[model samples]
Target: MSLLELRAVSHGYRQGGLFAPRTAKSVLRDASLQIAPGECVALLGPTGSGKSTLGRLALGLERPWAGDVRFDGAPLHDRRGRIAPVTRRAIQAVFQDPHGATSPRLTCLEVLAEPLRAGSTGKAALRDQATALLRDVGLDPALLDRLAHRLSGGQLQRLCIARALAPAPRLVLLDEAVNSLDLETQALVLGLLRELRRRRGIAYLFVTHDLRLVKGFADRCYVMQDGQPIEVADPFGPGLVPPAMAALRAAILPALPGPRPLRQPAAANAVLP
Candidate 1:
């Protein structure tokens, strides 16, 4: 069975004046997708295209107005039943901003320990697990005493990833998780994610707008347009070869510098009024 499945799922937001009858602005329209165990699927799209919404749906943050979202053949709705505590630990997320994800008041040790504490694990075990996770993400165990505000953006992002892995989740949702980092940092985090997946057999739903990044990083890619998935393809396929999708492809490639203005022949050292 697919690890995660969204079958004909649809969702919308109720907006406008509350006094008047509110209208539901649909963001997802019968969206269907599936991710198998140990497979990393990248969801690519422009802004307002429902990529984040779809991630939320997969994480059981929002209920679909139609259809069903299932994990291991069971629906994710409350009526069907809440996800078991053990099952909940199997699905975790790392969002776009690490600063926002990590508590400013918490040190790295505290941040990583929180999940284990919540899981009722012993403090000694939590410390060992958190230290190991930090090491796995290429961070120094000594840095664990530093507060969130003291770390660089890249370090903070890695911390968030480590925290997500603390529960030993089988699937990790990365919702534009690396968008705010520099190119070097982005590459580092991406490499770390890939390595972790290989070593741990963890699956990922990588949502982002950079198709170029996905081209080389993802095994498969799904394109979303206006809240709907328009295309899905293998990274090596012609799915991104069409003219209509060219813009997205181009956006992902290394940006070229604009042409430099021509010099005015040095003006012969004369001053002009």
Candidate 2:
């Protein structure tokens, strides 16, 4: 059974709207997809293709303009337009910017513990779990005292993952999570995601534009164009892919560039202070 489903969802944002016969610029039109337990699926598309919008829909952060969003076979939102606490905890997201994902004012330990406080776990256990989770994601417990701003992107992102996992979510939405990191950091984060999945049976929805990243990381890939899933193909299967996607894949697949020159971080080695 699918853990989450977006059934024929259509959504858009209002344009020129301050009372001028509001018009919506449609982004997702009849878009649908699913993620099953323990599966690593990807929503692949270039910028402005509405991948992030779909990610928000999947995370129950927003309701579609039309169609239903289901989690574990139930509607994600109630008639009151409120999401259940379980749904909120079950569907967590880690976005492109770790700096944005975590609160700069909070220490690493506080950030990780924030999610767990909603649970029944005692305070001491929460701290222990936070420490263990940090270590699991390849960080030192000492860093827990550091503010989120103190760590590099890679370390902070790992901290983000730990915070997301604190609630023991069933599905994780990695929305371009590695797009901001250096090549080495990206590789490490990807490996950490794989390891976490292997150990915890967690499923991942990798939202990205890099076909190279999707090609090796995801089991099933959905290529999006103009906010619709046009092609659903297996990354490893040669016969299943379409010719156009194949050609584009060939063009961009050769060398998956790491972080570009100017944007590259000074240290991506999971550095600690």
Candidate 3:
């Protein structure tokens, strides 16, 4: 069974001033994709192509305007249009900007500890669990004292990954997870993601514009165009990508500080926000 599935989902946003007539801006049109347990699936598209919106759908963060999002064979939104607490805990996400996503008032320890609130373990062991999780994400336990704004981008992102893993989620949605990092940090985070999946058996739904992000990691890649996922292709296959995107990657990628990817163009290493 698929761990996550979006079936014929049509989503859009309402835009306009309160007095003016509202206009609906369509973002997704009958778009659908599936992520099987233990599989890494990547959604590739340019910004505004609805990739992040699709990630939100997969996370149950928003109710689709049409169609259904199913997790483990059950609808994500109940009749009340609320995502159940249990379902929310089973899926987690790491976005592009760790600084914007987290609370500035909370220390890393406090933020990471939030997810443990849903666990069966008593209060006594929760701190220990937090420390363990930081280690699991390859972060230092000492850095827990720093607030979100005080840490480097890579450090803050690693903390976000630790928080996401705190609940032992079945699926992890990585929406442009490494896009903001320099080449070295990007490589480190990518390696960490690979290790996390191998060690935890957790599946991934990667929302990205850089196909290089999926080349060696994902089993399947879904390319979005025209407000929908238009093609599904194997990451290792040729003739699956648009020529323009390939050209941009070739022309725009910076000189990487780390070793070059075997299959991706240098533009795949761009530190795009």
Candidate 4:
């Protein structure tokens, strides 16, 4: 069974002033997606293609105008139209801008400890947990004392990722998580995420516009257009790229100079008990 599923979901935003008649600007139309446990699925699309909007629907940040968002076979919102705490904790997200993801005033330790504090009450225990999360994301635990604004882009992004994992989530929505970083940092963060997945068996909805990054990173890729998936392809398989994907590839601006290779995590630190 899929860990996260969106079936024929349609969503839109209201646009207009109080004096003018409000109209729904449709962003998603009959969009369906699924992420099985331990699977990496990419939603590939360019800007204004409704990729992030679809992600918001999946996150239950906004109710879809149509269709259902289900997690582990149950509706994301219950009959009473409320998300359960377990469901909230089970699904997490890491967005593109790490700087904007959390409060600038928060220290690195505090950022991670925020999620972990729900279960563990002691400060020392929380510190230890936060330290471990930093280490898990290949960050230096010594930086825990540093304020979020003081950290570099890569460090802050890694810290944000560590926070997402603090909840022990089953599914993570990575909405262009590495897109804002430098090429080298993007590769590093991607490698860290891959390692975490291997250790935790977590499913990821890896949303992005970069097709090259999806090559070895995603098991399956969904090419979205105008709020819906127009094509689905297996990234690792030997087959012709779908028309939509081909077009997207052609449109890419060669950000990596020559050949852009998706980074793979080192084998030695891949698995953990």
Q: Clashes in model 1: which pairs? A: none
**Whose lDDT is greatest here?**
4
Candidate 2 lDDT, tens digit per residue, 192-249? 9999999999999998877767756787888776568765656545675655456557
TM-score of each: 0.87, 0.87, 0.86, 0.89
Model 4 lDDT per residue over 194-257, tens place: 9899999999999998877887788888988667876565633457766667677667744447
> What lDDT score is found at residue 57 in candidate 2?
91
Give the poorly placed runs of model 1, Cα more than 4 Å off. 234-244, 253-273
How many angstroms is residue 128 displaced in model 1 relative to the true structure, after the best TM-score fit?
Answer: 1.4
Decreasing TM-score order of the candidates: 4, 1, 2, 3
Candidate 4 lDDT at 199 equals 94
Best by TM-score: 4
How big is the positional error of residue 229 in model 3, measured in Å on the Cα after superposition? 1.2
